[model samples]
Target: MRASLPIERSLTAEQTTALGEFRARWAAVRRSTTPADRSAAEQAVRLAYHAAGLERPARIVWCDSPLALAGRVCRASHDDGGNVRSRLVDHVRRRVASLIERRVLRKVLVAVENSVNPADPLVTAVAEAVIRSVPEPSLSMLGHLRCTGLSWSGVLHAIIAPRGFASCAAGPHDLSWLGVYDYLREVLRLHAETEPLCGLMQLASSVGWLQPHARTCWLAERPNLLCGDARDRLHQADGPALRYPDGWSVWAWRGVEVPRWIIERRDQITLAAIDEQMDVQVRRCMIEIMTPECYVALGGATRIAEDETGILWRRNWLAADAWAAVEVINATPEPDGTRRHFFLQVPANLRTAREAVAWTYGMRAEAYAQLVQRT
Candidate 1:
């Protein structure tokens, strides 16, 4: 359980300076919207296996997304429905998963602290603090309020991954910790093994998610159209947040992942559909897309309550729970001589629109009442 090196209590002046340099370099990697460097990724994967003293795979299978590997991994654990590829991939996974973890991931994932509980105290805490202090959103993606300019959207988020995949590389996103290692290495001037670290970086920079196996490696191609909001959360209002070359796409609103229909098929995100959504955030996104004015006027939103701040509206689904929103008019008039109306979605506990708008601003109703809001 020993750490690779002893980290000091605080970063030195030079080390703190290196943090910015590394953040910019890593952010470019995470923000890459290029196709996978197939030849380079293949070479890197082979070199990583060699560094770990494992046999190089006979072939590298190119996939559009991690979901491709995930799908095969799921079928391997369950029924393959007569898919020969699934069966073969499943066989390879069983034979090599344990071996790869012990021999390959263990050698390079030192950054993940061998255990989530690192032998070194405060390693994760320090890592968190270092990343979160940066203003760049993608670089500080794992923490809250790391970037400016964003009001509320994407200030917080969750990275949900499918189960069944074993230890693997997450392309550039792996830089979240790898860059930390770079910082530490430069700062401390430690003489740790360099081959494994280099191989990890090469693999991460050349491909998307990577899964190694006995005979073949699964390497996902980087999305050709990856984007993020101000807070560095995956988001696209008009189309897919991230889209792979093979037409595979993930749609998002603000930062919340939702169905493609909610983003594109505007006519389909009806009041009934919004009410049917169990996740409150996803439903709110739908309302945002539909525009609160249309949602209430067309969908028969009842006026539940009203106050000086706004009017509260509610609608109950036939078989599901009810939804509530606060309608507030923007005090500022547009060039066309009309005021803008905004609908703020609030928690179920809030009764009045005043509380709802106040919640959006992250304040108590009493405190918010004392000030005037333009929007």
Candidate 2:
């Protein structure tokens, strides 16, 4: 139940200053960074560790994309009598066993997302399968939450693999919410522009996407966004001074509480190993996958670049960071709607037995394990 940060040895002034310099250099050099940039940043950090005469942090790997697997099954629920869920679950069990046999590890993580409309039977079944996978020491059901209601819709949750509690802990600042938001938004926009959502909504609905009637009823009790008063409030809040209103600040309503299951579990999840490279204020953990390489490149420099898929990538992690930094900016608006600001930066739990099959291999350690058997 304790959520506060644990006390740790504070860095010396010299070390602290060095850290700041490193971050600035990272941001600057990363201006054109891409997936390649991510690896470069890690390399830079590694070089810094050696130059600073500090020990490199150990890398620990973790996993959590469980609900993603369920999503695959749910998408196929309309086909072949919708037996995909059962088949998916069976695949998950075998995969876990296979990982165990490979001596990967004992514990795995899993997650499920809350339904916004009415709960769907397929989602429920997926949840059940995921829950059953836990309980054994081999599995640890960290927690679950609802999508922030932005782009993820029903597909934001995850589960860790080879279960056990994370050996390291992450802090709020260690997270890059702006990075996440930008990544998701950019991905959605690209997909929409190219393939487009097409029948996605219809497909989801046919398979129980909008079944959360209770949720809809609950949300209906709140104020509407179209009202003049509401508009005024929104306008005042969303002004230049505020950048974009804080997600919680604007979306929060009185007398309404997100279910404990949603809030108590996790605010962020990471796969990176615990290390000195992590921001002190952020909450992050190590995963074995080679993601920071991709993320670094995606976040730092590659502005308006095309992804590997040849799709236009417009998601700006820096912009998302800018929006999140509004609170930090603490801008005082003049008669005109503008405020000068200093730069600022900052920062899922889920359960279930649901599983996914990987179609390929030769990824990083974590990615390889995920894809080994299915491919």
Candidate 3:
């Protein structure tokens, strides 16, 4: 019996004639008495079938006469087996890698061409203040503190505030309020020259670094505080206080406020008596001012943004799950008709901070090239 051709479409006269000749050749080869001749003929038929785009049956029986013949034929064509396919795959991979590199290079060039100086007086002032205020160890600890997934401001307030061992009287923990007073003394000593107590405390409270009780007091008593609007908004929403380890607590209102007392008495506060009151409170807790080196080390990254007014430097740092960001607006006019002063905003966690710093450094060349291209 003659095998049926696996053509999907109607064949032209020439193709039909060619197929007839091929079938005849196949028949003649099959009729050969010698095993070797029959083998060669079968191989030729299988190759022809493949070239004609005929798909083999899904369930192939190698031992069956016709199927075995086709299998032998296909095997003959692939004597080298898989080597060519692997080389082709590798060639495609290399091409893809090259394409990606070229694209990145182009993007970097574009970025550089459009770049501007990101330096601003505000950024400098904030950086300087951080450097002067925070110690290295304390700065490093910021990241770890963020890992707890609590508010940075809340933690800061807890560190700075006087301990309330009296509050923990019901708990298994035994503590002393004396330690709180001692800690305050140390804080006064540390911040004696640079910042005022009221300012620091107020800043901490405003930023969510203060304990719930203290923050509530500030908000209730000083309803006229700069964060009055924020306080009102929070009050309207009625959020719950977040508690942390070591008796630290904070509410949802995280706003920026600069108290008038701090501005006025910043230079006048004296730390003369703080030394005598110095005790274990400072040593037991983690509290230090932020510094430039520590900030950079903590993975602070900066970028420049331009608008109709001028260019601004945008700084970002990672802390735990959150991001602490600041924008240094360039000579931009405020609602108050005064140029803005330099100030550092929020603090970030450690790992993210480190990663940001690393990424910025690693991409510096590409970034510069892009900025240059923009110009």
Candidate 4:
């Protein structure tokens, strides 16, 4: 449980210059004459930092108000009428101005979750308003789109287990991914200790959030001196650390490859019956497990290993299943000299492993020989 991740080296000249430019632009935006100019400048900051080679680092910073325009424009419907749209634009302008002043580094990705029922009129209206004010190809839209073809287990499990998402935006925040893990683990343990007398909760959700509209967000700032091999090690050492209550879950998918195992397992874990749909895609997989201990742990489908062809089995409070494929995207050296392996475990009876793996990956038994190979 204890480990020391090496501190990354300093920034490159190009990155140094990029950061300098970002600062200058931000300063100007802070002094801008109008909201429109300010919002435009904010967008520029995001584009510039992302364009640079910054990877996931520790802590992400940004001003919520300034990025409002980009948020609003992207969510507006064409038929929502010009007045509503116009208001969204103005909101964006004001928000952008404030954001520049806040000095939020562009190296962070922001997610807003609607704590209210998705159907709540106010929630919908706010979401719409935020969306309407955003710039083209809204950040949220891009992030969600990247999640397409991924089952809920794929998304949520990845959030819980360690792995890199293919389309993670930005870098790390104040709490390194590993730090966040410890934080969550402690929070979960404490929650199980106290709370209502309804028995100890065993999963992630057992840790309650103070905010009603709870969501998680991710940011990956490329640390200096961590690239190529070292970067790969860093990722394996600190993959997909979660920051809960960010209003949405965010994964920093950098230098991480897809393992066929995870994809295959997903096929078995899905809600669809074996013959319910063909040439179909599975959206979410839910499993419930009843343990003899009277402690139930929910398992969500997950993408586990980068080298293998199976889904990582991930368990959280929502799942009731005992065993599942949790994907291991990265590996870190342990205190006893053993590698601290991170895997996405998916729910499966021992008998179902092969079928689940095959179904998800679409590979023949002979082809799966490697997966069966004990490392």
Best by lDDT: 1
Residues 1-375, candidate 1: write the lDDT tens digits.
985434244445765566567666555565567887888888887776665556676667787866565443332311111112222233332443343343334433343232221232122222222233222322122321221123344332212221223222233433344554444355445324333555556666777666554455668877688656776566788898767777767787777778888888888887678767888778778887888788889965888889888998887654345667888998899999999888777665678888888899999987888776533
Candidate 1 least-lDDT 10 residues: 77-86
Better of 1 and 3 by TM-score: 1
- The better candidate by lDDT, 2 or 4, is 4
Give one digit per residue, the lDDT tens place, for model 2 in 50-73.
332334323211112222222222
Each candidate structure's TM-score, on Cα atoms with residue i matched to residue i, is: 0.66, 0.14, 0.15, 0.20
C-alpha RMSD for every candidate: 14.3, 29.7, 35.4, 22.7
lDDT of 4 by residue, 172-287 (tens): 11001122112212322322212221111111111110000001111111111221223322112123211222222112222222222223343343333322322211112122
lDDT of 3 by residue, 270-363 (tens): 2321122233222111111232223334444343433332223333322222223333333688888877633233334322322333244454
Clashing pairs in 1: none
Query: Candidate 2, after superposition: displacement of residue 229 in Å?
Result: 20
Off by over 4 Å in 4: 1-342, 345-351, 355-364, 370-375
lDDT of 3: 0.26
Per-residue lDDT, model 4, residue 348, is 49
